[model samples]
Target: MQRQTTIKKDVSYRGIGLHSGREVSMRLLPAPADTGIVFVRTDAGGRQIHARAANVTSTLRATTVEENGVKVFTIEHLMSALHAHRIDNVCVELNAEEPPVADGSSLAYFDLIESAGIEELRSERHEIVIDRVCRIDDEATGRFVMALPYDGFRVSFISLNPHKLIGTQYEDFHIDAQTYRREIAPARTIAYEKEIDQLREMGLGLGGSLENVIVYNDEGWINPLHFADELVRHKILDVIGDLRLAGIIRGHVIAAASGHALNTALAKQIAASLG
Candidate 1:
């Protein structure tokens, strides 16, 4: 069995929320084994929320957790980064209601997590291995997901758009701490200008600007730092956060046209079967 690990030091960053548009600061601190993933709201008298899919109460625009009406928002990217890296135990202390959207990707968190260094604990690592093929479907949105057997955790994703710029993208990858950091961590959050305007009308994406996220125009990327394969890479990052809802899915996962809602539904179903 593998051992648990905690960071050797504290690491911090600052940025705005993609939706809320509010500036936030967060710190990653090492914690003892079995701590799971905890989010501490340093802004609200230290309210702590555990990173369990079952605790998810809101996923309207982003993943959110609420305890006694105190909520933490836009947590998927950071959660994905942590789970992808296999850093199972850590205390995420935040000075706001949401984590900073640094560059709108997991890269910042990846760097902080790496800088802290990993120290293993004596306890054996635990994961909810997938023994059966489980799936979830959203008929209204036509988004679907499935988790199947594999030697290790992996993801296959496909988007349903046909535009030359963002059309029919898919990628499959094996997930390990090192591989995720180098391969997927740099993939930034993205959206179309029309969608951005709509979200902004609803008072969302306040933290979203050209600096943090990659914006797509009618013809192509509006951001200067465009990658040929960024679409697929970003999808993989989303899959990481979605599967995290499984509370530890231990096998390979294959999914297509899926989003955060479907991912969490699959997690809830798989978690239910665990009993």
Candidate 2:
């Protein structure tokens, strides 16, 4: 049977939070069996928030978690990395409002987990294997996520960016620790000049630079992809992170024209139903 796992030792890192633009320090500490993944804001007197879809208060541009007016933003990338590494229970301690952006992908997250190592727990894992078809949609953008019954989890993604370099990138992958780390973890987030300008107007993406996220103009693929299929692989990486809001998922997910908003919406719907 698939068992729960946790970091064998504590791992730490420091970087700028994608949205907050403030330097933050975070540590991933091993937790007892069945503890589940929990985020504690040490900067706020140790406020603990369970990593579950129900706690997601906002999906505006990025996933945001809230409890009693306390908020954490830009969490999907880190959470996705943890999940991809097959970590089941962890104590994520942060000294700021958000986790570090770290190259805008899960690559660094993967590296940290590799350094810390993984240990199995006594308890068996609970996976949300879909027995019914479910879907969520954004009418204006025609973006949606659909889940179906399957033996193992998988994701198919299609991204549409107006930038000529990133107009339409498609990727499909069966979700697994090996495949995720090898294929998806290196896909950096892509952005357009127009959107960056808009984010600047709203005082967001203040820490974003071409170094962390791939900035594209009308030209195609400005950033060099570590993998030949980095664009689509990143989509799979994103799907993994977004699904974690459900706490854990065990079935296949197929999506098209989906982004953080739609992905989290589907996860919340699934998380609610499973309860």
Give the candidate number with the greatest lDDT: 2
Runs in model 1 lying further than 4 Å from the true structure = none
Alpha-carbon lDDT, every model = 0.80, 0.82
lDDT of 1 by residue, 1-275 (tens): 87877778888888787787787888898899888888998888888888777888877767887775578878888888878777878898888888988898888887888888888888877777888998998888778888887778888888778677778877878888878887788888888887887888888888888888888888878886545678678777877886676566677777777777888788777778851
Residue 152 alpha-carbon offset, candidate 2, angstroms = 1.3
Candidate 1 — worst ten consecutive residues by lDDT sum? 224-233
On a 0 to 100 scale, what is the lDDT of residue 118 in model 2? 95
Per-prediction tally of clashes: 3, 1
